[model samples]
Target chain A: MSAALFSPAAPGASPSASPGSPELRAQFPILARKVHKQPLIYLDNAATTQKPQCVIDALTHCYTHWNANVHRGVHLLSQEATEHYEGARKVVAQFIGAALPEEIVFVRGATEGINLVAQTLGRTQLSKGDEVLITGLEHHSNIVPWQMLCAERGATLRVCPITDAGELVPGAFDALLASRTKIAAFSWVSNALGTVNPVAAMCRAAKRAGAITLVDACQAVPHFAVNVQELDCDFLVFSGHKLYAPNGSGVLWGRKALLESMPPWQGGGDMIASVTFEGSTWNHVPHKFEAGTPDYPAVAGMATALQWLQAIGLQRVQAHEAALLAEATERISAIKGVRIIGTAAAKASVLSFVIDGVHPHDIGTILDRKGIAIRAGHHCAQPVMDRLGLAATARASFGVSNTSADIDALVEGIVAVQKLFGA
Target chain B: MSDLGDLYHDMILGHAKAPRNFGKLDPCDASALGHNPLCGDRIGVTLLLSQGRVTDVRFDGSGCAICTASASLMTEGVKGRTRAEIDTVFQRVHDLVTGKGDPEDPELGKLAVFGGVSEFPMRVKCATLPWHTLNAAFDNSNAPVSTE
Candidate 1:
């Protein structure tokens, strides 16, 4: 909780000289375990990050001390639970630089967050002949919801294409933006490829086009810092599990005016203010969106994860992960018959590649045998795969606890795969 | 219990490297597509069925090593066999891959190489996808078969 923990070189640091300091690795208990009789080298951070002991302890503490439904009872345990839940919202608001905590709504994860916006705000704003603009680099979560919304409202879903290097094509967004564009949604960083989109510039363009913007920050939030106020997007959403917190915990931050204007997506116990046999009134901004009993423990865990990241400082995390990614990219590219996907000039910490005469599933299986885990498939971005003319690619995404040694192991595993396939 | 060596045996690798009966069979009696949505592995099976017997078979698509090799070996195994005989072989192969039947069972023949697949629960579907597609082809069903 103190700024002192943000020091680049903490006291009693190991002299072994690892990019991800040994001290940081020690905080995650799973890193110490073995898989297949070998030390586990996890490289799938983009899918979901490993939780630190502090976050796990926070979940346990909340469940043990105040295991009650939030915001309903006047009992001490209920008050404590409500306080922790609301406190988590404030932490998320501050972490993402929202103007007020009331703008943040807790949900199951990024998928739910996007669906909520698509159903509520999209239903209210969209009509016939309107358009919902998205990019070709979006995950299925971002694409399907907009498609559903457009189909329901008789609107059109327009897609901006990406370059061969996986970057958004130059001037494609502007060309696609027209008077009919009602909402523009794109990912801040692609989960399949590491391409980092020009979010602020895109937001500015969307605003000028008289369109509301929603940024999928699930991949961006874990790798670096995000300030919604500076980006000036109308809404942003991210998941907690990708940030080293528990699953089923996430945040959807919208402009206060927009959240107040949209209707509640789901209806249940907590989202309603008053109820009669015939009708019901909705609660305030965030609570109106959060129906039923929330996952209070997960919220507390997410708050602890945010505080832990703050203590480490996102800038340091960004630097460490970038160094690892650079080393990985350089070493992996040197191998014969290996191709790197998504060669964007600007990217986050994801490394995706394909080897000649070898399928990604085979690569993943061989790597898993060596205790080096990576994702190998379309990664739920089939459109991106189709664009790249590939069935799938093997992806190794880095995290704060990853070191150069993990990258070395990955390179060795790739060599072994090539040998196995005789490529 | 399954090692990488056993999973990627020499036979599996050889068959995968140069798959047999790979291509579309034009003017065939029936054909069906098998898709594994989980890994995006797809394979199509086409055969010439006459008098309730498979005279010729061909399979073509993209898939992992296990899947590709399984489909290759299946094309060679199922040729010149009746539908009931092919079904019998499919049951034994299913048991062999699931570790329920003896690996040394004389009925398995070259399919014994897949005895290692049982160790990987996830790969079971990959090994069985071609057989499922073949079943669909016999029925002449146009709907694609998915190993969900």
Candidate 2:
């Protein structure tokens, strides 16, 4: 309201201020909401995002018209279904700058996508002496899978430490990338801390060391202009829900030859070339990873979600979200006893912090009562919590639909928590 | 931001801010740690039992308002009550949380306020984490209960 307020978004710009930002928010009817008799301030995009009208429409469109099971029948509906399903692949490929459609294997989301690679790629190559390089700033979804993979094989899971400011120390990451390092998997943008890793350089370093790099773009894809080609990582994964797409749908993009060589991770119907009682010949690359009845409705919604982002342009979304993050960071961090967690020099649109002496859960409950949705806890990044010597931290992540008004509400809500805790 | 005051009645925030009998018991004989890694709620319930009565009960946990309050309330409710009485209270609270049990168990006392938690599916765990931790900690008790 004052001249002192610094709006990162240019004049007349909102989160959905991109070309189709308004239309996209319109698609996600939930954005039009009120909470606890107040206007909804959804700062929990990092947790899960509100779906736009197009994503909702696409989902409804599939069930309303062509709801046939894909990759089974050769009927008119089946052909239509297959075309739309495969079309989504191209949409996602273009969305992330993947080299080919085959590289983008549709999984249940980033969690499952990470598990798929850890199970398949990890199983095939990782041996006892082999070290799986990862950072302490990973979600349990990223850490647990490799732990299981390493436990299954004789492999070891090595961690790259984070700096006090929450950025991954580049030199430490490089130091961890030794000869035994089979793979280096880290979040392109950390979910808990919102620290965006130096992907292009990090991936380049990993590649030179002959290690497969898996980038969890779950948080990044929603807030930044991410290009798989630009990063040139061996594999990249992101979730649909974070990108304003439906849940149970995600993309796992790998280099062509590397993904092609791996066997099917899960086996059922569509992933098979020929099914015999004794043995089954596997299908091609994408299908090989995509086993059983995929979430067609969700995939349809996800494709539209990506298309929605494309229409708005990633750069505009980035700018809008960045402004929100900066405004929120400066305002919320100024609150007494509230320490901002991740202070990476270069970051995306997430503002994570913890109110001193106040458990994040208490802060979360207080905020939710005010109808301001924010994520509080380890954020599935237990390793990060362990490093920070914290049980949990509260995170307020941004999206295109968010506004300065929401940040104001969040600041007020956090102040309430701080005062209540006497922090 | 208007205060949704009813949701954060002073009692709830009061309990969360300055919990009664907070922190772990050193010689925790019957202690079990139930962790909700999703929300990072961890509760360590130490039951100081003698014969059948719970005698003096204590809990140490770090979690949201509801979970900590629930843990605090449990220590108050179960103290001086027999093992069978504790079992009944646990069932009442479990049902109140997981939606399988009745929220309106008359003996549940002020703890019944958490019944509204089922409205928010995610917070169900927040409401139930302490109760679940209590059950798990009393695993050897086998005192006829249902968390279903």
Candidate 3:
């Protein structure tokens, strides 16, 4: 297990890229430290992840060297900050395979990105009784915005249910694609159950129905090569903090025409082109949505984070993470009293499970004391929890830095809980 | 690294396996249902009050071992006690499980093992669901309140 942590044909010096080399681990300064005197077996990648030294260095440079407000500065420092910030936009655009940089709008994260789409798109076209086709596996961020929109405009929210096996029934999504369905918002990967949804195929189906498609790619982007054009999705969103960048930064990429048609979400500074105290004109596609003074430094950090991810190569990362997932599911599922959820054929690095008698919260607390960090709760997907007939689940997600030994720590922790609970 | 104290003590496991008042109380003077939806821990709290004093207390629900045990233990500590005395117990349990301070109150003997739970922030709600329901049941202003 230790030898096979994340090494699947080393992608050069990147940790996990090289088999049997721990040098990549040093890039992340936090992995060396221990919690409760035990080495930190960090597995809660679904919630967030530890930043690499490159990302941390970018953050430091933004504050220590080229610190300035973006889009409005005239001095050298401001010019440098503006260049780096826009450079981040280009990096993010390339990362998602967007056709143009202006199509990418930097928002806070996935939550705000969803809210922006719901508010703008729903208000623009959706009328009362129109339907929004979503799945039972959607996170609260995806569900709540549509709910609020539906309630306001008398539009109804339609749910695409999942099978007992936790896979999205192939044509089940197609069945929900009614003529009344205006927008189809779904997570590219189910955060709760680690179900990797086929967004490209699903979006193609939605396009055939004339219903617009949007994806919450927060979970998918970190592990896979996300090509918005390949997906053919009308709109795609993801967060920076979850992508190894600093907090308060994310990207919402849409087709140029689709973004141009949408209205501005918030009003204030930086979104307007001209103000005469009589009538104000909005900026271009991306700038029109990015309101107020944005998190410039964080955006710079995100660019650097994307660089690090690209350095490892997304395809290699995805394959390695998938291999790790396969090994983990095989071993962890065989344990008595351990029932893994989301047994879908397609899955990301996330693994959610429940022990027979131990509460998820209890499992989390016990794991934390042992310095093995895992996310335990509903994972902000209460609807999925309800669908599975559970209140919460213990989730262990993998990242580039995660090793097979981390899974061992998790199994050991579960065994300890079983011994204590007499399960 | 999980201690028996962190998961369950012998008494808590015993009570959770078989709670004392594990049935519904008919014609109950006060009743409340508390659920930590996060954990699917649901408890029906029924109170039989005699002139503002808690003459009888019973709770039945489904949850994990720790929560079920905590709920079972809660019913025993508050039976035949006054509202004023029960409030103190609630506060003590909240503090103990939530990691504040325990003042050696005899009612909190076996419950003291839960003092180790505070380090884990997510489980605090699970351990306190029953106690919160008990407090709401004592308050007669409304029907069963949601102690989220």
Candidate 4:
């Protein structure tokens, strides 16, 4: 990599647009914490990211100042809460380049967002013998929901395979997009392997084949910019927690026409236009899908998270993570018996690896001793592990706050594991 | 942070590198697979039972050091023991790893190396995978048992 990649801006300095600025790390309070009497080196961004102080403050501000149920009351607290909540929706819509704010539906996380689509859109659009084409590189959330949709609708789920290098097998997706294919859902970035799938191309092909496309952008949204219009996907889902917001916050951005046509998957107080003992009419598009009392503070916090990320600039974050990934890949691969899994040409923040004699769980344990945090398992994408013929791999995924020093710490941790295993 | 010595004692690492009785038995009548869905540590335990005793026991699969070492030590502990004896050993090992069994239980012997497993709560599953699979094998349950 470049020498500039290793150098970070001085700590406690003003924010700079340049990659690996110390100001970026200063914004997150958790990054200052210690683990095991050592400075924490958190590299598990694919699981979730650390929230910046601004996002945390935004959550507290929402609860402290504007705590009220959204969109229902004509009272002042309710109106202020409603404004911020709807404001967050508009911000999310703009972040993803959705056609309208109504196209963005709030869900618990990417898992729930996907399940909403699978139940509402998939249930209505699919028929018996219809195939939902997903890739072999899906997290269980993406896989199981479609499986349930298929099982309930008498449809089938088909997978497009991946190569040994973890890239999608070329032309496999197109080959599987047969006449009966109904929906084609895939990840924009593989959470397990860090492979950045050719989502725009895949979505284009799926659309040409008359299939609705849903891009699981859970991993993608954190590391880089995602413009839904640019990708031209019918539906896209991402978790707010992965984007440096709190848990229980996520977005499912769909085309307005599609959301309009689909019936609400859930029934609750807020989702109804008119409710009787025996009958009910659904509310408007986005509200129709979001039922019950929403987490308004989380919604406000998610908006702040988006704004914080915007201030940092996604391009800078992408470059910063890419540099870290390159440094990690080079350093970790240089170690004997350490094989880096998922060598896709275009990967973002994730670096998955396995030592020849040491199990990933052991690697995780050893790393934890040195105050390093990483995910050690199939990464909820067991299908990817199954495809790679590995039970599990130790994964170190990057975030905006990570630096080359963190990567160095990770390398040292791996060396310690090798020594422990006598590899 | 956990102390590495407590979790991966020398004996555990040694047995992991070269586990004993690690292969499928040809004449095995009872066998069951155990899988740790969390880490994908799979252990296929094969038992050759004669009358009411486990005449021969073997296990084969891929797993972490704790799992492999536990399996290897268990083979030495369970061989030639009656089914009831094996059950007691299993219970003791389970209790020992979970920090609930008597450490001075003389029957534990070499198996006591895993007593440190309780220090790292997450690793208890890794240490106990083979024992659970052994139970399933003895019970003649074909379905894979999962340590979720």
User: Pick by DockQ: which candidate is best?
Assistant: 4
Give the backbone clash total of model 1: 0
Candidate 1: residue A174 Cα off by (Å): 1.0
Off by over 4 Å in 2: A1-27, A419-423, B1-15, B23-29, B76-79, B88-148
- What is every candidate's C-alpha DockQ against the true complex, given to 2 decimals? 0.68, 0.48, 0.56, 0.75
Question: What fraction of the reference structure's interface contacts does model 1 contain?
Answer: 0.74
Listed per model in order, the count of residue pairs whose N, CA or C atoms clash below 3 Å is 0, 9, 3, 0
Q: For each candidate, give the interface RMSD after superposing the true interface residues on Cα.
A: 2.0, 2.5, 2.5, 1.7
* Candidate lDDT values, in order: 0.91, 0.79, 0.82, 0.88
- Give the DockQ (C-alpha) for candidate 1: 0.68
Report per-prediction Cα RMSD to one decimal: 2.9, 6.4, 4.6, 4.7
Angstrom error of the Cα, residue B143, model 1: value is 1.3
Residue B133 miss distance in model 2 (angstroms)? 3.9
- Kindly give the stretch of ten consecutive residues in candidate 2 chain B with the minimal lDDT sum: B139-148
**Tens-digit per-residue lDDT, A305-377, candidate 2:** 7766766778888888888788888898787788998898877877888887777876877788788888887
Off by over 4 Å in 3: A1-21, B1-7, B37-40, B98-103, B107-110, B118-122, B141-148
Best by lDDT: 1
- Which segments of model 1 are wrong by more than 4 Å? A1-19
> Can you list the residue pairs that collide in candidate 1?
none
